[model samples]
Target: MGLKPWQKALFPLRSVAAVVRLFEAELRQPEPDLVLLSLVLGFVEHFLAVNRVLPTNVPGLTFESRPGPDPQTRLYFPVAELSIVAALYARFTAQIRGAVDLSLYPRPDGCSSRELVRKVSDVIWNSLSRSYFKDRAHIQSLFSFITGEEGPPRVPPGTKLDSSGVAFAVVGACQVLGLPDVHLALSEDHAWVAFGAGGSQTAEVTWHGKGNEDRRGQPVQAGVAERSWLYLKGSYLRCTRHMEVAFMVCAINPSIDGHTDSLELLQLQQRLLWLLYDMGHLDRYPMALGNLADLEELEPTPGRPDPLTLYHQGIHSARTYYNNEHIYPYLYLAGFHCRNKNVKEALEAWADTATVIQE
Candidate 1:
């Protein structure tokens, strides 16, 4: 059944218009509009038929928004860079279709719109899933569900530690676990994770590292004389393969409970060492050495030996950081191993290390 002339004439252009309209609608939202547009545009370029122009109302071209970690990180394309890419793809793709029609499909242009879109989207998606927005949304959801009950109202940006500050709750857990070797590594540019076994694996818990920050000049804070944006440009955030190996090991260990029993502690520590090695950190002596050093530095609090032994200890410690989700893994480590006698001192130091999140 040969198609009617009018039907063929309208299909391709209508499809192009529909995709463009979708981009326009997405850009109006407060969230990462550009990131969403990039994904959608890429899809259109790679898969949409080019023979007929379709309107912007086509349902197939629309992508449903998938729930992800709050404020998820994807490829950090500058607004201008993204605008250019999306606009070019949209325009050129339609042009290709028009050209193909003129040539009677016997020989379409060498560069198909669909093929180019596929290539670009694939690269963007891979970089995004690994480098940013891995499992942040789920962590946020879990946190809200656990702690949103009646309390001294929780504020946004709770505790402010640049990237490496440990959540206060974890420090309290340290007191409970009696493991002096656990401590948070503070940095302004990146979030990092490092532990000596016995932590939670409900999601991807990885440490962030400090990549050098480029100078923007001057401290914007009122009291401080120095000011600069704590931004790292062209910095690639990555976890060594060992982190994954560690993640898997921690997931199966039975010693990761909150009881802090001696038998469990021994097993957890043994399992942790194996994970650290799997993460390729066996030769990276300093990180492990640092953990031990942190353990030794905890000042013994007279009364609060098992800081986490008390239920309130968790609340008090968590008070130090606004959003406590980032450090849940560390809390699991400290809570599972630390004993009551010396955990308080470590908890105090961890508290002092964190900066309260500012509005």
Candidate 2:
């Protein structure tokens, strides 16, 4: 199989030198779209239907033969073209401004006040013409309006962005509106934004699990006391833009079928995570570290920390960032041990998770 018309349009990299060049540029890149990670993932997924890239029948996480081989491999990480990235950026920036009378929602406290956050949230939330069907599956990407898109056609009306996409959209819109104080807040299974000085205030920018009341723009106070994994026992990450980029990278979906993956996409994800990790972006994002650790467990990266160390680092991230209340980091470690049949270590990890729960 040769390059498809659209993939060719991306100017896909076919050599190792291209990877090195892009990786260096990426470390210094500012705008989210410039890296165009989301676009790259979306681009591969766009061709999946016609790809006939069958699932590898390999047993577990680690694969026997990786997707591509040597220099002539089909797997190439595409740095998104500047024109498309700029067009999407400008579109979202304009939408955020034109969609609302932003002056009416001033940041009263000289930072991201609760009202201003709410107004931004409302703009994204209300845009959901099909609010009732928001949880539909897809991948999310950057742009002022975060969203999930699938298939090769234009997104149909009433197709809402995934939950984090909504939160990212709010934060992104705020950024376009000139408020760097607003940043993404993430629990294990949900996403929102934290704002105000020192991120002292929190608000829901997207819907949570199914059948819950729409809490968009409401403060996340009571849930911390409710004390459930639903809220990570108050364990949340208030992410900087770099950390958010790591999350977006962590969220990349490369699955092709039951036991198959898009090798290029997975490789792209792994390399990008390493890039972010070296830049110290994943320090506060436990789950992203956990995600990288999982990949390393399957395909160990030389000159990098091993899977077990990375897993513990994720827990340590939870410890430092959220006072060790978060449990998913522990759970990730436990799962790893269990999978490797390290029963004793697995039990200890579970115990550590329980200790966090009891706190």
Candidate 3:
């Protein structure tokens, strides 16, 4: 989507020029804030394809792929520079409180470059995770699964840089400094930041090497075969094609086994089956329902509950919780049956749904 007029007004190209000037002037005797800001601006400039720095003479840097459960694009940085950036970012967060006012650029309300970076990180992180996960705890658990850790590290909470954290921080810092062309590409294996206008205008940085030369040709591995459940503030059904959903499940329940069946799982699967039916993906409904059936036959264990019991219990909970709105499930179910030529079943489901809606 195109940037709104207000967003463009908030981040004008002139802001980039101002930061570039600051970066050039402060290259010598660079303050922590200035250095961090400079790096952020530089990346933004590179993303824009502006010839701010000559290619042959650019500073020597080492490129590293971001480590996480999800797929991540590679990041290139000057060796040993991240420590300084991280420390500055931490200091910046200590000074700022509340929302970042980007209009006051170059020195927003006398906030230093360090403060700017922190503010940017806070803004971007909050926006990105708003609907996907609950809080830092969710992020922590997701990070742990990606790293195969028993749990997230016990770091005293404040701004500390890690492999996964720095990318978002950098993106946020760059964004506030007037490079508003950032985009995030999320997939089952990894998530990475991209730059430029989306569609034909979008561009992403990649390391060119022997093995990486054919990166575009690499095939994406399929996720779970069966339909999966996703629970946030509300519950939803997801398909294997839903890479982000699959990634979230694996991250949150890293050790979940046996079809990933649970009360939540069964409900989600049923929901997805109905959705597929409603969306006219008739061929997928049976496949999804079959997944639910498979779950039903699996023996109940301490962790893996009986699918049949969970299915009924889930429907009861949905009806009790949603009451009038509970027709959503039946609506999808009716659609599924109708599409599959089961006229009687469709009518029965629709009747139940209409009763609830009418009441």
Candidate 4:
């Protein structure tokens, strides 16, 4: 059968446009219909299948092919899979919306948008896993659809962290910590923070922890052993080990030696480290304080009025500066101490940080 020239050209264009418009419209609404969203995604899948754009073995629930009396074709999703998608979508959207609404309520700790997205993804994954015991790939596709990811969920090579989640979390942490000017630099397997013109100042704050077992079946311990090292201006500062303390020293180094450039460097480093910790990279604390102890061992930079005196002065100045920040670091330090079995110090730190928070 021969088709009209205009019909062939316009049909595919209209089909693609419809799918795009459906998603665009759905996203603009505060509360979109989950069933409608699922239908739109299904429509896209079907369109791809009809046009032979998608490979035959693509992961996800397959639409049963039905031959019609006429030349026209259509796609049909399994009733069971569609039901699961709708249910999962409803649960995810409700929880996400609730978390966002609750963030408005007064509290010392606030939730970030990245956290909200994670919460939603977790809930959806859990719900789907519980309901659909098989077809992991199909479940992932459905998840990707609801989360607006291009394809199935994947952990990037050479990293355990979800790049999308980390990127979003870093941005959210910056906004929360009042460092709006800080920018994120992302690569295929890593992401970090950068500040200043041309990103002259940079910090790698992403977590790089080893999981339970390596390829050799060796037990991989977490914490400092699994901590990823950070670089500053192509120089290995070992800042990842004692991220917070490193930032403090850097921030106050200028006060010690009267160097404007070092002060700016430290300030940017401090902000980046704070965002990293707040974004749930908690295991770096072991290395963080350890790095602080090694600070005195560093060689004195040129033009310092008094090398020994300036080093001590910088340490003291950094401590005082951090102390004035309303006990934020103390709370984290308390957790670090507790994790390291310093119960007495943890208790004291917690008590002090709590008092500040209460006031």
Candidate 5:
């Protein structure tokens, strides 16, 4: 990759110029794999921060991971960084491929693709130090999977991947195995993989709640049939690559502490969410619409729809696509209405929410 002449460059960041030039062509492909680059970059940021390689106190002087559930742990995220991404991507890909050879798991099983997914899940699930803390926030990503540093070096061992991370790892591994059909399936609190024909096949690849071992090889429909609120009665996202990227966008944590947010990270998340929204990827993913609506409410984009419109679209998506089975979209809209002092409308929204609950 040739960098433009330095004299012609406003700021001579050769690496940035190289990646920008690379992306210009990559972005034009029928479908660009920006999500891979994004996740890898995110992992690099977290790896740098959590190893105590970067100081946390100063905003600009040093990078710091954002605070998650655990105040003691943080993960940094930088948008343009690419140097570490390539190496990490290769290592992580090889790590999973080495875990489960594709020849042993050629296609989806009758058991909802479990055989293949569990192999991927086990690699991540078993990688953590024995007795690591599972409640840390930022560890629910590939950063933890790749670096094995759930928190700062001083934070001590026992950093297990959160349940979602295992599922994400499985889906990502399948992608690495060249299985584009495999994708992440998400409900309110659980994550799994959807694969096979039309992404109709599904399997549990992560533990849902504590104490019980993971039901790693079971089909998802059991929960739906059992009427578990966790399944939302067939309401869940069988995500495409784009929607999965939106999921990562919604998962962005910008808190430097409980009180402050990284404006740069927040702005990046908002821009990415808006990009996905404009690309029509959020149509079936109501919670994404609600998440983007939350951002729009806080930062009101100049030319986009108002937060109320976004909220309503979320509700509409739930009703139309998920048969009104999803409750969050309604609750999100109701919360917005209540916060805005729309007393009568809020009550109506609440009533509608109750109707969904009754179903």
Candidate 6:
């Protein structure tokens, strides 16, 4: 039977309680510092992607992936965020050209590179997070000195260069900014953000290797294409696929037990499920929401007065997916989820609906 009005009202409240308890349980988990760091980095990466500090074509750099409860595991983001961040960074690096010495820190350790890259990314992210970058001139100044004269002709495909496609995207970004291209090498196995092109002081990205450049066989103007893709395709490839993997891994992996409570993960899943529902994805099958609730049931309940209230809270507290507006996936999932129910039969009767959407 459908829930009475009173029961429905209680539902959202119960969800909220579940969320709070889950959050508290998560807080109580060991090594809270690591979890906080992951959240910070995740937020930083999300901001960078949202603001275009990185490139979109590079593999293993997307913000779509959620950090797992396991602190030891690192998640990779996709190219869309990377492309945007790289473009913004390229612009900033262009401005800081002469002022900052790239040579002093050439080929630094992975941690150093991550630190340096994170710093610049953070600057752009923080600026946007604070909503303070009021003018283009300030942005231009940030990138002016970093861009230099033209560098080596575009790196040939077959030949390995110390620069990744993301680096060149930055180079191409310099071109976009009218800054001369700069060339420099970063250590292999990693993408580098360094200074020195052909013109005056310039910065370059150099780190060529498998999974670093665009292996998808995108065109030479690929950098331009990548920028366009990031600007247009909010759920670029990595966010779509890689993110799923990260979540799936987090959900299924049982080996890394103590650091993150499984029940909290289930609670998180419930929250995600409701978010999907609120977005109209689960309108056809309320049971899918029930599926998530069942999962969250595995976790021990907190001191909250009602379990349902906690669940709704968790749903409200979960982060929104990268782009929640576009509805293709929602429609697809709705169709799939309702296949055996009344919704499915109705959809089948209105087969033309699917065709119309495709057209």
lDDT of 2 by residue, 1-359 (tens): 22224433544333333443454455565544322444444433433422344435512211122245775654433334445444554555666788767678666667877878888888777766553455433435443133333434774544356778778767767877778888888888888888889899898877767775688778888887777666777777778777777776776667766677766666667888898888888888888989999999888888999999999999888888788977788999999999999999999999999998787
lDDT of each residue in 57-137, candidate 1, tens digit only = 533343323333356822111111234334433443333333233232121323222222222222222222222322221
lDDT tens per residue, model 6, 168-220: 33332322222222221221122223332221121223322433332221222
Which ranges of candidate 4 are over 4 A from the true structure? 1-15, 24-88, 97-186, 190-359
Q: Model 4, range 160-248, lDDT digits (tens) per residue?
A: 11322333333333433333334444321234444434434444333333331111111112221433221211222212212322222
Against the true structure, candidate 1 reaches a TM-score of: 0.21
The top-ranked prediction according to TM-score is 5
The TM-scores, one per candidate, come to 0.21, 0.79, 0.24, 0.25, 0.79, 0.24
Sorted on TM-score, best first, the list reads 5, 2, 4, 6, 3, 1
Model 1 / residue 297 / CA error / Å: 16
Backbone clashes, candidate 6: 63
Q: What CA root-mean-square deviation does each model show from the true structure? A: 22.9, 7.5, 21.5, 22.2, 6.8, 20.1
In candidate 6, residue 222 scores what lDDT?
A: 38
Best model number under lDDT: 2
User: Over all chains combined, what TM-score does candidate 5 have?
Assistant: 0.79
Q: What's the residue-level lDDT of 271 in candidate 2? A: 86
Whichever of 1 and 5 has more lDDT, that candidate is: 5
Candidate-wise lDDT, in order: 0.28, 0.68, 0.34, 0.34, 0.67, 0.31
Model 6 segments beyond 4 Å from truth?
A: 1-265, 271-328, 335-340, 343-359
Comparing candidate 3 with candidate 6, which one achieves the higher lDDT?
A: 3
